[model samples]
Target chain A: MSTNPANHSTPVNTAAGKLAVGWALVGVPLAYGVYETLTRVAALFG
Target chain B: MGFLDRERTIAPAGFNRWLVPPAALAVHLCIGQAYATSVYKTALVKHFGASLTEIGLIFSIAIVMLGLSAAIMGTWVDRNGPRKAMFTSAMFWTGGFLIGSLGIFTHQLWLVYLGYGVVGGIGLGIGYISPVSTLIKWFPDRPGLATGMAIMGFGGGALIASPVSTALLKAYDPNSGAQGWVASGDAVGKLFLTLAVAYLVYMLFGAFTIKVPADGWRPAGFDPATVKAAKLVTTENVSARNAVKTPQFWLVWVALFCNVTAGIGILEQAAPMIQDFFRTSDGASAVSAAVAAGFVGLLSIGNMAGRFAWSATSDITGRKRIYMLYLGVGAVLYTVLALAGSSTTILYVALAFLIISFYGGGFATVPAYLRDLFGTFQVGAIHGRLLTAWSAAGVAGPLIVNAFLDAQGKPGQLTAASYQPALLTMVALLVVGFVANLLVKPVSARFHEPRPDRERPHEPAMEA
Candidate 1:
């Protein structure tokens, strides 16, 4: 029987990549919030 | 179906703990729809030909149920990992939206209440607490900051949902008349449908991605000995049932109740409060609806920023001192707003912003405060019980504000002077909370669970 390499956990940079993904998840929403606020503020001034 | 089982939800040694916040955020952002109920309040009232109070009851039920379910479900969440809990939350929340849509489409108001209020509120409750204990375990070094990020999503969820709900309503009824811009019950029904579909998918990300940290896991290089436990900060653990038996829990409850009630008083009527406070001399209003909406938008930012910033500050200043600032300084800010708010627009916004920040701070810091008093043994459950303060405040806060305002005159007809009574009342409420905060001590030793022989290994060392 051949052991599937993809099925096994590798001692590579996994946590860092997961951590970066986490930051991106939060960042997308935060960036959208900024855009929403900016437009709302513009409407107030407009 | 087995894909989301608990075996899949354990954090591997090399797994990034940071991934947990966004998972929590995903659930919170969906449940936060509870805050955006006002968007549909008018349309529902028109559809049912009911009083504004009747429509308002929908939101009230949801908030009440949220508190109840959280208290009830907290222990279950603590016992099970976040995966099963979040999956349950997603199902109920999505089901609430779908059933609620059916109610609107069928013109049955009770169905809306049962669907959105009862079922969905449970979703909010479980969803709210589901990720909390996980975040605390993951960020043992910064529990306040971690929980704040997720809870902040609860505050900001309304911000995202409000606009999306409005846009959907507009698309559903582009030719809406002047008297009713939200279209009608049919549009609202469709809106609920869209929301249910979108949220179910979004919440799946959280349910699938979230994992409980391995038992006894701590952040790297962080020592438990380094945290000098103050007299108020306990080193022991207390079960949720035992936690309720402590004087400290009740004191913290009173503190949270007062803080939420006062802040919610402002939050419930932020737009009208500002407009009424600074009404023009000639009788025309100074603040426009657009401007009021803008103000609400700005308050959302303040609420969100305060959650992250103040809770992070609590990590440094100590949870007790940050709360002291929330209750103590909160009183001062409210008083200033009451007195000077009538004349100075700048002071009004500035003071209101500061007051709101503290309000948000109270929410973000309290979980960490609970951890300080009761150990993580059942912190989620205890926090669940603690949120009843918010539920009670949800009713009490708006009542205090509205009752005072109505006694003076109608909402729009009243002047800044009319708000003085309510504002002053909030200051007094803050004083009560401040006293409660002062009285909080460590949970007594009687409540501590005897240390077990072997920590319950949730894992069985089997391959899934």
Candidate 2:
């Protein structure tokens, strides 16, 4: 599907800023969790 | 409260579809904390001076409640929309932590059961399915990728929660050790309060930001007819009530049940199974406790990654073909592990990791699979009912593995030879899943619901 934000008419909540913030809210924490788990996983090779 | 209504959540014409996934992730990440209960299991056991089984029951109750609440409330979620459902889920989930915290402070075990197990479980159930259908609607061209992103959060949630909970317990209890530290009950109670507040904020953010695509809205350049032309892809709708009557639904359920049961067998036993496989004749293990833990962490990564990577692959390969790989290849992996898994630790880890990835794939792909067979109309509800298989497998998987192990020998003393029976059993179960996936045909025309004139502007009308 087209990855562009819907541009047919006036956008409602689809602003570029809002999309960045939304992704950050969930992404930062998920990334942190994965990072911590990876640190532990390093022990297997060590 | 009105802000949580379905109509209020409809996306405006220019709303970015990409934004919806993060909203779904917010809820899933918070609810996925359910899997991290082991972080505090020992602390609760020490605080209450209870048996291991009693503390374990808290998680069991939560999982059982997750399946039950999802099945019972799925239709309600479908009718009410994602916003209201997410709001309700946040309330129950955080409230569960609140009540559970109170139970810990008061040293009342039953209260913890009521709070975390029953109340929080309902939250897990609702929050799990809430964003699924909306995500599907937003990305009709790539339903697997959309649902995979959200459900992947569920697996990732525990990854964050495990380490986070440990750190919180240390902060709450100054005496908590770096190794084998069991926080005091008081510290655990405080930890719950913190999680309750943190999760509430995250979940509410998700509920507020989430939006349903306006009816008849398809992504630009996405044609429903193209989707329909694919094998088993349907543009027609099916009511949640009638979905249960179809053979396709049950076949999928059986397939999921088998896949999960086999996967859980490995997951539940991962840490010890590794040590046992490499145990020396002198009764010492080559794998250390710390390394065994790393193995578990590695499996979590596999589990989380497969949810996204394999499920996204389904968009191109088709759901049926992807499941064939999961079940068919999964059975072969199990046999290899059972026979030669003891030969080398690296080999064993690779086999186990791939099997767990397929297990995760089974979960992430099923919703899209349902959409293919049943359509979007009540896909969330059907997906919810299908989760009863997960709850059953949660029980059956451990039971089957443990029963075989018990017959062979005791827990800590058993070797790879003892695990062979259970491993072979899982191999047999995956074969059952493979056959079930083979039998899944499209939902028959007699079961199709008449298309609503307002809903499908781009597709042909259904016969019924």
Native contacts present in each candidate (fraction): 0.32, 0.83
The Cα local distance difference test for each model comes to 0.84, 0.93
**Cα lDDT of model 2 by residue, B1-464, tens digit:** 78888999998766789999999999999999998999999999999999999999999999999999999999899999999999999999999999999999999999999999999999999999999999999999999999999999999999999999989999999887657667999999999999999999999999999999998998999988889888789887777788888889999999999999999999999999999999988999999999999999999999999999999999999999999999999999999999999999899999999999999999999999999998999899999999999999999999999999999998789898899899999999999999999999887776777554554443423333
Q: How many clashes does each candidate structure show, in the order listed?
A: 0, 0
| Per-model chain A TM | 0.55, 0.69
TM-score of each: 0.92, 0.95
Ten residues in sequence with the least summed lDDT for candidate 2 chain B: B455-464
State the interface C-alpha RMSD of candidate 1: 4.0
In candidate 2, stretches whose alpha carbon ends up further than 4 angstroms from where it belongs are A1-14, B177-180, B452-464
Give the least accurate 10-residue stretch of model 1 chain A, judged by summed lDDT.
A1-10
Ignoring the other chain, what TM-score does chain B have in each prediction? 0.95, 0.97
Off by over 4 Å in 1: A1-17, A20-26, A42-46, B1-7, B174-180, B452-464
- Poorest 10 consecutive residues by lDDT, candidate 1 chain B: B455-464
